[model samples]
Target: MPEFTYDMLVIGSGPAGQRAAIQAAKLGKRVAMAERRGVVGGACINTGTIPSKTLREAVLHLSGYRLRSLYGASYTVKQHITMEDLLFRTDHVVRHEIDVTLHQLMRNDVDLFNAHAQFVDPHTLRLIDLDKRGTRAMRHLSAATIVIAAGTEATRDEHIPFDGQRICSSDDVLQMQRLPHSLAVVGAGVIGLEYASLFAALGVRVTLIDKRQRLLSFIDAEIVDTLAHHLRENRVTLRLGEEVSGMEPFNDVSGDRVRIQLASGKQVVTDAALYSIGRTGATNDRGRISVNERYQTNVPHIYAVGDVIGFPSLASTSMEQGRLAACHAFGVEATSVPALFPYGVYSIPEISMVGRTEEELTAEGVPYEVGKAHYREIARGQIIGDTIGLLKLIFHLQTHALLGVHIIGDGASELIHIGQAVLSLNAPIEYFVNTVFNYPTLAECYKTAAFDGINRLGGVRQDAVATSSRN
Candidate 1:
C-alpha cells in the first residue's frame, strides 16, 4: 500500500463529520477534521438542531403552553417572551457542545484545521485558511480516506428573495434582532411548522401556508390531522393547498412587514415572512466526489453522508452515517443502519414514527390493520390535561408482526423509540399487548394500542379459520 500522510480527513463538523472523525480516532487512526466555521460544532449545534430545539424549549416554557390548561390563560404573568429570553441559553449550550467536540478531538489526537477544504483530487484536498494566525493562507494535504459530512443548507430562490428583515429562512430565525408581532411561514414542512408553532406559542399571530392539501403528507394521516388541530388551537392560521404568487416588502408602516399574494388571490401582510420550502445538500455545485450506495463519492477515497446525501436529514441518522463511513474507510465491520428509522418533527405537539407510511403500505397492497389510542384514554395525559395526543400502531395482517408506529403529541420522539426497537427486532404487536406498562403513563397508550391491534388480528385469524373449515 502507498504511504498516506493521514488515515482519515473529515470535512464538515456537523454531527456526521464529528462522529466519523471521533470513530476514526477511536480506531487510533491519525485524523484531520476541516471545518468552515470558527467553531468546531457544525450546523446541528450552531444553527440547526440544537439551537432550534433549545429555542423551542424556551418558547414552550415561556408561553405557558405546557401548563396552560392547569394554570389557565392568566397563568402568564408576562404576556410576551422576548427573543433574548429564548436565545439566552443558546450561546451557553452551543459553547458547551463545541467544547465537548473539541475535547473529543483533543483526546483522540485528531488535528483540527479551521479552513475550507476543496478537492484537488480523491486523495488530495486543498485547504484555504481564513484565520490570520496562520502564516500559510493555503495548503494541500493528502489522506488515505476522506469523509464528507458537510450536511445541508437552506435553499433560497430568486423569485422569493430573502431580506432577513422581511423574508427569511430557518437559519435566520434564531439570529433575528427582534421578535415579530405577526409572522407568516411559507411551507408547512418540519422546519416551517416548528417555527410557526414556536412563534405562535409566543403570542405572535402566525399563518402557515403549505402547497399540500394536508400538512405532513409523509406522516400517518391521523397523526398529521391531530397535529394540524393543535396548530389551529394554538391560533396558527393554516392555509393549506395555497400557492405563493409573489412577495413585496411592506414599508411606510409602524412595523416592518412583508406582503404575500397567494394563488387564491388573497393577500396577507405580516411583520416577517419565513420561507422554509426545503433544504439542499451542501455539496458545492462544483463538488467532484462521486457518491455510491455505501456513501462513496466519485473520488473513491471520498465519502458523503448526512443531509448532503439527501433522504433522511435527521441528526440521529447522520451521526450513525458518520460513524459507519469512518468504519468503512478503516476496513472495519459496521452494522447496517436500519431503514425503519424513526422520523421526528420537533414542532409543538411533536410527531414521530418508524417504518412505512399508510400510503406506502396501501400502494404496495400489503394487508394491514391499524390500532389507535387517544391520549385522553391514558392516565398521564389526563393528569397533564393533554387530551389531544394519540398513538397509532400498524401491523401486518398475515403475521401479526409490528409494521409501524406513529404518534403525535408530547413525548412522541421518546415514545417512538419503543416502536423502533420492536420493529428492529421484528417483534409482533403481542409484545406491546402482553407487556405491562406503568399505570397512567403515556406509554400505556401504546399498550392499549397493542391490545387493540391484537384483537383485530384475532378477528382476522378467526375469520380465516372459519373459511378454512368451510373449505
Candidate 2:
C-alpha cells in the first residue's frame, strides 16, 4: 500500500527538471522526478553536451589540429584513430556525470522514478514503468505543482532511410561504429555546425547545407564571416540557401552512400549523412501551452520550462527557468534577468555572445563604437596557436559604457564571462583600461581592446593612457 504524493513533480531529469526538483526540495516541500530513460541526467549529460564536447576534444587532440601552427599539419599524436578511441573518453565521462547527478538528487532527498509519465488529469500523472520483460506496471502520482521538462528528440525524415548506420539522425550519430571519409550535415543550426567542425578537423570532407543563406543570423556578422572563412579553410563546404528536396540511401561496390537531391536540380552524394534538421518535443503540447513571463500554463497547476518552452533553448537559461518556475509556483518571490543569460556555441573556435549585437545596436539607431582584440596579438593566443581568434567589444560612443561582448576563439566560452560580469554591472570601458591583469594571459585582451576603443574615441593624452595602465 504505497501512496505516491508530493508537493512538486518534474517529468524529465534534464537540466531544467533537475534544478526545479532541487529548488522545491530545498524549500522543505516533498519533491519527486520521473525520467523515462532510467538515467538521472537527460540528453544534456548523457548525449548532447558531454558526449559532443568530449568527441570534439578527442578529434582535436588525435588530429593535432590545435598545434598545427607550431608542429606542422601532419603532426598527429596518433597515426590512425578509431571509433573506440573517440568513444573511450565520451563513455567514461558520461558515466561519471550520471553518477554525480544521481548522487546530487539523492543528497537533496528527491524521489526518483524510472518510468514514462503522462497526465491522467490536470494534477495527476500515470507513470508507466519501463520494464525489460515487456510488462509495464502502472502507478498514479498526484502533486500540487507539476513541471514538464521532457526535452526533445532529433527530427528525422520519413522518406530518408535511417538504419542508424550509413544514414542516421543526430542522436544516432554518436552510436556510429565506422568513420566515413565524407559527411553531409543537412542543417546549419548549432548542432550541425559543431558536428561539422569536429569531423572536418579529423580530415572528413563535410558538406554543410541549409535553407538559410547565412550562418548564425543572431551572431555578429563580422564574427560569422571569420568563422565561415575558417571553416572553409578546414575543407568544410558551405551549401547555404539550398533545400533538400529528397534523399535516397543506397549501396554500391564502394559500400554505402546517400544521394541527396536539392531543389535546384543539383545532387550531392556523400558517404554518410547526419540529419539534424531540428528537434521535436517528446511529450504532448499540454494543451499547446503559451509560456509567459512566469513559467505557468493556461492550466493552473501545470508549468513548462527548457527546450519544451522553445527559443534560446540553452541548458544555462533552462536551469534558471526551472528555478524561477519553482519559486513562482510557491510564491517565494524571485526575478529573472534574461539579458544576462549568455549563449555559447560549441563549434571549432566556438562563439560566445552576451548583451547586444552590432546588428541590434545599429537597427535601434544606438550610437556605438567597436573595439576588437585579435588572438594573434596576445601572448597567450600565440602560445595556444589560435591566430584566427577575435574578440569584439561594443561600447556606447558617448557614454563609453560596454554594450556587448562577442568572442570567437579558443576558450571563448570561458572568456566571455569576464565581459558578461562587466556588462551586467553596467561598467564603463575605463574599468577594463584601469584594471591590471596578469601578464601573458588571454585576459589582457580586455585591457588591449579597451585601449583600442579609447584611442578610437580620440582626445586621450599619452600621459593619461600611461596613468590608467599603471592603475
Candidate 3:
C-alpha cells in the first residue's frame, strides 16, 4: 500500500461527511475532513436543516399555530413577532448543533481543515485556506480513500437580481433583516413549500408559485391536498401552473418591492421573494460519475453521498450513506436498504411516508387497499389541538401485508418510523391490529388505521390467515 497523509479524506462537514469521517476514525483509520465553512456542521446545521427547523418551531410557538385549536381562531402567543424573536431560538440551536458536530469530530480524532478542497488529482486534493491565521495559503492533502459529501448550493436564475434582503435564495433566508409582510416563493418544490409554510405560519401573506400544476406530485395526492388545504387555511395563496416570465425590482418611497410577471400576463407584487427553484452540487457537477452499490464513483477510491448524489437529499439518509460508504471503503461487511427509508417533509403540518404511494401502486397495477385514521377522531389529536392530522395505511388486499404508510400532521416524522418497521419486516396489518398502543397517544392511529383496513377486507384474507381462522 502507498503511504498517504490520511487513510480517509472527507469533503464537507455536513451529516454525510461527518458520519464518513467518524466511521473511518472508528475503524482505526486516520480520517480528516475539509469544511469550507468556518463552522463544522455545514449547511445542515447552519443555513439548511437546523436553522429552518428551529425557525419553524419558533414560528409555531410565537404564532400560536400549535395551540390554535384549543384557543380561538384569532389567537396568538405574541402580538408582535420579529425576525430577532425567531432568530434568537434558531441561532441558539444552530450554535449548539455546530458545537455537537465539532465535539464529535474532535473526540473521534478526525483532523479538521477549514479550507476549500480542490481536486489536484485522483489521490490528491489541493486545499485553499479560508482563514488568514493559516501559515500557508494553500496545502496539499493525499488520502487512500475520499468521500464527496460537500452537499449543494441553492440554484439562482441570472435574471433575478438578488440583494440578499428583498430577493433571496433558500440559502439566505436566515439572513433576512426582517420578516416580510408578504413573500413570493417561486417553485413549489420541498424547499419552496417548506419556506412558504414557515412564513405563512408567521402571518405573512405567502404566494407559492410553481410551474407544475400539482404540489408535491411524488407524494400521495391526498396528503398533498391536505397540506395544501392547511396552507390555504394559513392564508398561503397557491399559484400552480404559473411560469415566471420575469421579475422587476423597484424602490418606492416606503421600501423596495418586486413585481413577478407571469407567463399568463398576471403580475404579483410582493415585499420579498425566495427563488427556490432547485440546488446544484457545491463542489462540482460530478454527478455524471457512475457510483456502484458500494457508493464508489467511477474512480473506485472515490465515493459520493448525501445531497451531492441528489434525490433523497435528507440529513438522515445522508448519514447512513456516509456510514455505509466508509464501511465499504474499509472492506467491512455492510448492507443498504434504500427502499425502507422514510421521507419526511418539514413543512408547517409536516409529512412523512415510507414504502410505496397509492399513485405508485396504481401505476404498477398492484392490488392494494387503504385504511385511514383521522386526527380529529384520535384522543391525542384532540388533546394536542391538532385536528387535521391523518394517518393512512396501505395494505396488499389479498396478502394482508403492509405496503405503505403515510402520515400528515403533528409528529408525522416520528410516527412514520412505526410503519417503516412493519414494512421493513414484511409484517401484515394484523401486527398493528393486534398490537397495543398507549392510550391518548398518536401511535394509536396505527391500530385504528390497521383495524379500519382489516374491516374493509370483509373477512377476506390470505390463505394462511383463513386456514388459521378455521382451525
What's the lDDT of the predicted structure labeled candidate 2? 0.87
By lDDT, the better pick of 1 and 3 is 3
Instruction: Point out where model 3 deviates above 4 Å.
Output: 132-136, 285-289, 460-471
List clashing residue pairs in candidate 3.
none
Residue by residue across 120-166, what tens digits does model 1's lDDT show? 97788899988666555898888999998877678776788687767
Candidate 2, residues 1-471, lDDT tens digits: the string is: 334488999999999999999999989989999999978788899879889999988888888888988888667888778878889999999999999999989999999999999889878989999688888989999999999988877887778888887887888899889888999999999999999998888888999999999999999999999999989998999999999998888888888889999998999999999988988787753322467888888886788988788877788888998999999889899987365768898899789988899899999999999888888989899999888888889999988899999899888899899999999899988888778889888888888888787777774534335433312
Clashes of 3: 0
Query: How do the residues 1-471 of candidate 3 rate in per-residue lDDT, one tens digit apiece?
Result: 888999999999999899999999999999999998878887889899999998989988999998988997678999888899999999999989988998999999999999889999999999888556665579999999999998888898888898889999999988999889999999899989999999998889999999999998878999999999999998999999999999878877768898999999999999999999988888665532346778898899999988888867889988999999999999998888365789889998999998989999999999999988999888899999999999999999778789999999999999999999889899888887667788889998988887677767676344223222201
Name the best candidate (by lDDT): 3
Better of 1 and 2 by lDDT: 2
Best by TM-score: 2
Task: Return the TM-score for each candidate structure.
Answer: 0.92, 0.96, 0.95
Consecutive 10-residue window with the lowest summed lDDT within model 3? 462-471
